[model samples]
Target: MLQSDVPIRVHANWRPLDPGVLGSAGPATYSRNFAGAPLTNTWYPIALANRIAGSDLAPNSVDINCNFSSVFNNWYFGTDGNPPVNQYDLMSVVLHELGHGLGFTGTMTVNNNGVGSWGGGTAFPVAYDRFGVNGSGQQLVSTSLFPNPSIALGQQLTSGTLFFNGTAARIANGGASPRIYAPSPFDPGSSFAHLDEATFPKGNPNSLMTPQIGTNEAIHSPGAIGMGVLQDLGWTFTTAMMADDSDGEKVGCCGTGKSAMMQDLKMPDAEQARLVDAAVELTKASVDQDDPKFYEQLSQSLMQLKQARSESIPVEPVNDAEESRRVFQPMRLRTTTPETERISVADDPVWRDNFIKWLSLPRRDRLRIWGGAPVLAGEFEHCVAVGGGGRFCCTGTLVAPRVVITAAHCFHLGCIGSRGEVYFGLNSNNPGTGRVVACKCVPHPDYKLSTDEHDIAVLILDQPVTDVAPCPIATPSQIDDAFFLRLAGFGLTETGRSGRKMQVEVVVASNNCSSSSHQSTFGCKRDREIVAGGNGLDSCNGDSGGPAYVDVGGRFLLAGATSRAAANSQRGCGDGGIYVRIDKELEWIESVVAAEGLSIACDSEDESEEQSNSGSVKKE
Candidate 1:
C-alpha cells in the first residue's frame, strides 16, 4: 500500500486541456505535429477515485477538447476510447502537473547573457499565487499555436493584470515569436500560486522549444526540460532510479553515474564572464585586424554594459545573525534561590586610574572606581605565573584526570604555541610537589580581550592524575550566596613582589556585597568578597582565572574566578583578589565541558542541599 502522510486537499474544478500538450518550435507560428511516445518511466495522477460521482474512468486516452466527470476534487476525466483527434491519457498528465501544483518540483530561473557565459544566471523562482490556471476568464490557446516568437511555450490568461513577472506579451495564432510574458499570469484578480520557473528541468538539449527540435517537430513536442524539472513529478517510484537494473548491471544516471545537481553560482560566474568577454574581444580585435582602438572600444562597451546592469540590480545583504544565534542556548539555573540572595557579582575598587594632564592631551583612558572597603585574605594554592614580564597571567584549578579549568584569556595567546604547566595540591614556596602536567589550553570562541565575554578556559593534561579531588560544577539550582566560598591562587606575595608565585593564606569572607558585573535577567549573581590577600579578600595577578569554591552540602560549588582589580589596587594576599563571575555563566561552562566530553568532579546534588540547610560551620 502507498503510505500517505501529509495529505493536501485537491483543488476543485481541475480540468486539463490535453493529456499530452504539444509545443511549437518558435513563438511566431501555429503548427500541428505528431505526439512523441508517452513518457513510461513516470507516473500520472487521475482524479481522486473516491470523489468521482458515478462511472469509473480507466486510465486511457481521451479527446483533448472533451471533459467528463472526475472522481476527486473538481477534476474531469474522459472515459471513452475513441482515438479522438487530440485526446490523450488523463491520469498521466495530471499526475505530472500535480507534482508542480503540490510543491514537489523545485522552482528556478536562468537568464542568458548572449556572449558572456556558457550557462545563464540561475536563481530559485518564487511560487506566487497569481499564476494559477484555475481562474475564470482564461483564454486557453491551442498548444499548436506559439504564444510569442521568443517565448515558445508560455500561457497568457490575463491581459493587464497578468504578466510573466515583467516579460513581453503576445497573441495566439502565431502572431508574435513566443516570449515568456508576465502580464497574462499576473492579472489583477488572478491568484498565481505555486508557479515557478525553476520547476522546469534545465540544460536539456532535445526539447520542443529547443533549437534542435526545429519547426517540424515543435508543433508535436513538449518543451525542453529547463532549469528545474524533476522525474519524481509523475513517476510512481519514491526516488528516480539512476539507471536500468534489468540486467543486474549498475549504471550512473549521467553517462554512468548519478550525481546530485550542484551549481555554485558565486564561485564561477565572474570568472566565466571574464573569460568569455576577453575571448569575444580578442575575436573582434582579429576581425578588425589593424585597428586596436576598435577592439578596445568593444571591450569598453562590454564593461559599460556590465556596470549598467549591476547598477540597475542592487544586491541585498543576507542577515547572518540568526545563524550565529543558533550556536548559543538560553542559560537557566536548575534549582531555585531566594529572591533576596540574587544580586550582582562584585563591586569596583575604591582607587581608580586617574587621568593625567597632558600638553597636547594624549588620548588615554583608565578605570574609574567609586567606593567599597577592600576585603583581604592570607594565603593561596594551585596558581602560577603565566607570562614573562608580568604583562598577563591567571589562576587555575586542577579539576580532573589531566584536566584544569581556568579563565580563557590567560593562556590564549601564549598557549597557541606553548602551554603553561599547572602547579596544584601544594602550598606556596614549593614546586613539583603536586601532580604537574603540561597544560593543553582550549579557549572559548566568545572570549574577547576587550569585553571579556566568555573569560573561561580549559586545560587538557598530557596525563591524568589522582592526587587531588576536582570541584563539582554548580547547577542552576545550587547558585547561592548563603554559602561563603574558599579562594586560592598564585599571586604576588606583596604589592611589589612580582616574580614569585606565592600562595595566599585562607580567610573567610561574606558573599554579600553587590557588584555591578553579573546583573542579567536570566541568572543570579554573588558580588560578595573573594580570596583577598592584604586588604582584599580574593585573588590577584596569578589569581585572575582561579576558582572560588564554596563547600555546599560537603561538595565544592565553584562560584567565581579572579578576573580583574582596580588600577594599582593593593590589599592583603587574601583581601583584594577580583574574580571572574562563574555562577552566572555556569550553563555556558557546562556546554563547553559537554562538547569536550569531559565530566566534572563534585558531590551529589541532594547532599549539597542537605548540607547547606543544616548550617554546618567549617574553618578553612
Candidate 2:
C-alpha cells in the first residue's frame, strides 16, 4: 500500500558471501536514525514510513543477500496462482525479506559466547526491543544483571528467552505470547532476529515472518498476529484499526490525525484543496458501504499529496557563485529580422566587469567563431558535443555534473557512435581538448520511433565535469509564450556546419505545431513539445539534443531540448521546430538522477530573491 514518487534503490547483484556467515536471504539497516528529536511525534510512524519510501540517506541502505547456488535455480518468479510443485515462490520470499527491511528485524548485534551490544556500546534500543521479555516474565531492559538497557535486551535475545509481551500481540495470537527465535547454540544471523519457527511454522497462516519457507507455500498478507506485532513495534497502518474492536480502540493510523499529515506536506493550494475534497468524498463512501477499495483510494491520495509536497520544495545549486556567472547580462537590442529581435552584445564594460571577474579569465582573451557570429565566451559553457572521435555529431546540455540531457533521435540517427564522448567547453571548433566518455545512455522507456512521444534520453558520464557549471531546468508553469528563448548548439547553420557553438533568440510560435505529414508521422503533443522559430532562426541538424534555454533572473534555465525540425516549414530550417519540454520530464529526470547517484545543480534561493532580480529584455 506504500506509494511515493521517490524510489527505494534496490541493489540485486550477486555477492559471494558464505551461506554459513549470513543465513537469511538478506539484511536491512536504517540509513538514518529516526529515534529522537522531531521524529518522536505522534505522526512519527507515518513520517518514518514516508521517509523510508523516499530516503536518499545512506543509512536507509537495505542489502538483500541471495544464495545463487544451483539449488535455488528452480524458483518460480511469476505471479500465476498455479506453478510446478517443485518450484519455490520467489515473490513471497522477497516480500517477507522486504518486511525485515521495513523495521521487522532488531538492530542488536551479539557475539558467539552470548555477549551482546548495540550501536557500538551506546546500547541504543529500537522500537522492537521495548516489548521483549524473559521466560520468567521479567522485562529484558529492567533486568538487574546488565546495567546498560540495550545490553540487557541483547542478552535476553541471546539467552533465547525473549518474547513479545504486548497485549495486542498476545490477544491476536489466540492468548499465547509470540516468542523470538533463540536456540541453545546461538546463530548470529538467525538467532534473535525472527519469529519462533516452531510456534509459527511454515504453511501456517501467520508464518510470513517466520525463519523458514516451505515448498508450494504462498503468504499473501502479514496475518492478524503479524500486524499486531508490527503495530506494537511503533509501526502504523493505513486501516482504521490494527486488530478487532476487542483488542484496542480504533486509532488514526495515518498519523495522530489527518491534519498532522497535511501539516507535514507542502503542496500548491489548488492541489491541496483537490486532495482534501477527494479525501472527504472517499471518507463518506467508506462510511456508507465499508468498501475496502476506499482505503486504497485514501492511501493513494496521501501518497500524491506527499509527492506534490516534495516537488514543491525548491532545489538550490551547490555553488551560488558559479550560478550567478551564467546569468545573461543584457546590453543592447536590434531587430535582426522582420519577426526576430536579437539581444546583441560586444566586449563592453559590463561584460568585462562581470564575465571576466566570474570566470577569472584574462581580459585580453578575444571571442572566436567558426562560421557564425561571436557568442558570449562563458554563456553556453554548459553546452557540449555528444559524439565520439573528436566529431560534433549532436549537442547536449549538462543538467547535472555527470548527466547530459539530449534528444532520443540523436541515438536513433546513429549520430552517437560507439564509446560516445561528451565534449565540455568545446568553445573552439576543436573537440579534442575537453571530452568525457559516456558510461551509459538511457532513453525514455516510452520513447517511440514512429511518433516520438517522449523524445528524450539521459547520458551518464564516466566521471563528473568540474570546469563548467550545469544549468537549472524550468518548471512546467515557467514555459509560456511571453518569453523568448536562446537556442544554442554546435549544429549546422544557413552557411554550413558550425565547428563552434552558436545561439540565436527566437520566439515561441505555437506550443502545438500541426501538419499532415507531422500528424501522420508523429503525433503533435502541445504539452510535451514547444514549436518556436522566427526571423530565419531555427535549430538544424547536429543541433539535435541541444538546449533551448530561457534567461530567468540572469540564470540560464533549460526550458526544452531540440527534438526535431517541423516538416512543413517552407524555409526548411528557418521555420519553427519541435523541442521536447523539459518541465514535462522533470520527474523522470529527478528519478533517474537519484537512481544513478548524480548531483544536479538547482537554484536554492528564496522566491523573493527570484522576484526582485527579474530582468527584462526585448521580445523576439
Candidate 3:
C-alpha cells in the first residue's frame, strides 16, 4: 500500500545485478555516489535502470554507493552522475519490489488465471506449471487465454501484449480499473508469466494476481516483492483508509503474533519442499470447490427454483378509461377549402423609416463586456447576431462588406424553403422592413438539438449592402456567470404572445442559465417550479431563436440561445423562457464549420455584398 507522507527506504549496498547484456538498451555506465551506506526512508526496485561497474576482483557483481545527504532526507540512486549507487542495479531492485507490492504470490498464473502446480514456487518464480499438459508430455495451453473465448479470465503468454503493459501493471494494490499500459516483451527463452486476480477491477489488462515473467535483469518493484514474501509467510495486510497517529503512515491491519502464517517454513531446500506441499493442498481444495460441472448444475438448479417460486399470474382490473379510450377514434380534418389568399411582402406597405431604424447603429456602449462588434481594418463594417436556434446560429458583424452573421440555429430550425425567410438590418420594431437579401442558410451537421447544445448557424445573402455593412465578428472565449448579457430578437415582446415582431433589449442578465436539468432556463419539471413568475424580463415564445450575449473584456460573446418555453405553457409563451447555454458547445460549433467547408465567422470576406448594396440604404 502507498503511504501519503512516509518515505520508503532502500539499502546502501545496492548495485547493478544484470546477467545478460544490456540487450535492447545500450551499455550505459554511470558514476557512483553512495557506495557504503544502506538507503533509508526511500523505496527501491529489485531491478533498476542503473548499471553496475565491475571491479578488478569480480566481473559478476558491482558495488553501489549511498551518499548520506540531508537534502534528499536519505540515500537514493539516480542515473545522473551525482548519485552514489549504480543506477541500473537500483532500477532492477525497485522493479522487483514493485511486483511484490502489487501482490504476485502463491500459485496463480496471469495468462489463463489458473493455479500453477508447484514443485516449489518462490515469491517471484522463474517458471510456470499452470499450463495443463497431455498424457504424451505435450504442453496444452489453457482454453481461457484466447480472446473473446467462452471462458472468463483468459490466459495470455505472448510478450509485447497490451494485456501485460507496464502502466496497467502499476495499477495493482487497489487501483482503478481499465488501466492502459505499454508492456515490455519478454526475452527469448524466458518462461515467466503473470497472474490475474478475480477481485481485480474489470478490464484491467495486467494484474499481479495474474502470473508474469520473473527476469533477474528486468526492472521490478522491491516493495511489491517484499509484500508478496509477507503474503507467502501467511500474513495478510489490510490497508486503512483513515490516518494513523503513530509514524503518521497510513495504518494497515497485518499479522501481529510471533507464530504468524508460514513461520515454520525453513529456507533453502527444506523451505522449497514445504512450499510445494502447501501449493498442492491449496490447488486441490480450489479444484474441488469450483469444478465446471458443479457450476453448470448449480445454475440449472437455481433456474428451476426461480420457476417454482413464481406466484400465480394476476388478472388486471377493468378500467373505464382503457375500454372507452380503446374504442375512441381520432377526429379527422375536413377538406373545406374556401379562403382568400394572404398578401405577400411585395404588396405590404413599404416602411423605409422602420428599415432605417432597424439598420441604426446597435447600442455598442450597452453591449456585454466580452461581446458586440470590434473595429475591423479597411473601410467595411460588419454586423453579427449571436443568439440563434439549432446549429446555423451565431453572431457576426458586417464590415465594409455587406455581411450578417447570426447563429446557425436561427436558420437551422426549418429546412430551406420550409423555413421563414431571414430578414437582417431591420429595426427593433419592424425587422422585415429592412432591405431583404434573400438568404442562403447553412447549418453545421454535428449540432444536436437534444440538450440545445452546439447551436451555431451562418447565413449567406445574395448581395451585400454597402451603406450598412456587417460588423466584424469577435473571437470565441469562455465566459462565467459574472459576465453580463444582452439580447436582441424578433421574438414576442411579452410571454405567450408570438407574432411577426422583433424586440431588442440591452438588459444586464446573468450569463448562466438557471438550471441545466430542464434543458433550458424556463423548462420546469412536474415536481419543480421556477420562482420567477412576475418578472417581465423573462424569455418568451418568440424569443425561441435569438442570441444571448456575454460581455467579456469589452468583447461581445454569443453566449446562449432562447431554447425552451415553460412546461404547461399556454399557446402564448410565458415567463421563464429557456435559452441554450452557448459556451459549453463551442468546440462542437467550430467542428461543424470546419467540416462544412465554410469559412470561420471571423474570416474577412462576404458573398452577400452585392445583395446588401442593391437596396439603397440611407444612414440613420
- Model 2, residue 266: C-alpha shift (Å): 62
Ranking by TM-score: 2, 1, 3
Q: For candidate 3, which ten residues in a row score worst on lDDT? A: 257-266
**Which has the greatest lDDT?**
2
* Global lDDT of model 3: 0.28
What lDDT tens digits, residue by residue, belong to model 1 across residues 195-237? 2222212232212122111111112223222112222121222
What lDDT is reached at residue 549 by model 1? Answer: 62
Q: What would the per-residue lDDT of candidate 3 be over residues 177-216, giving only the tens digit for each residue?
A: 1211212332211212223223322223333222221222
The candidate with the higher lDDT, 1 or 3, is 1
* Candidate 2 TM-score versus the reference: 0.37
List per-candidate RMSD values in Å: 28.6, 24.7, 30.6
TM-score of each: 0.31, 0.37, 0.27
TM-score of 1: 0.31
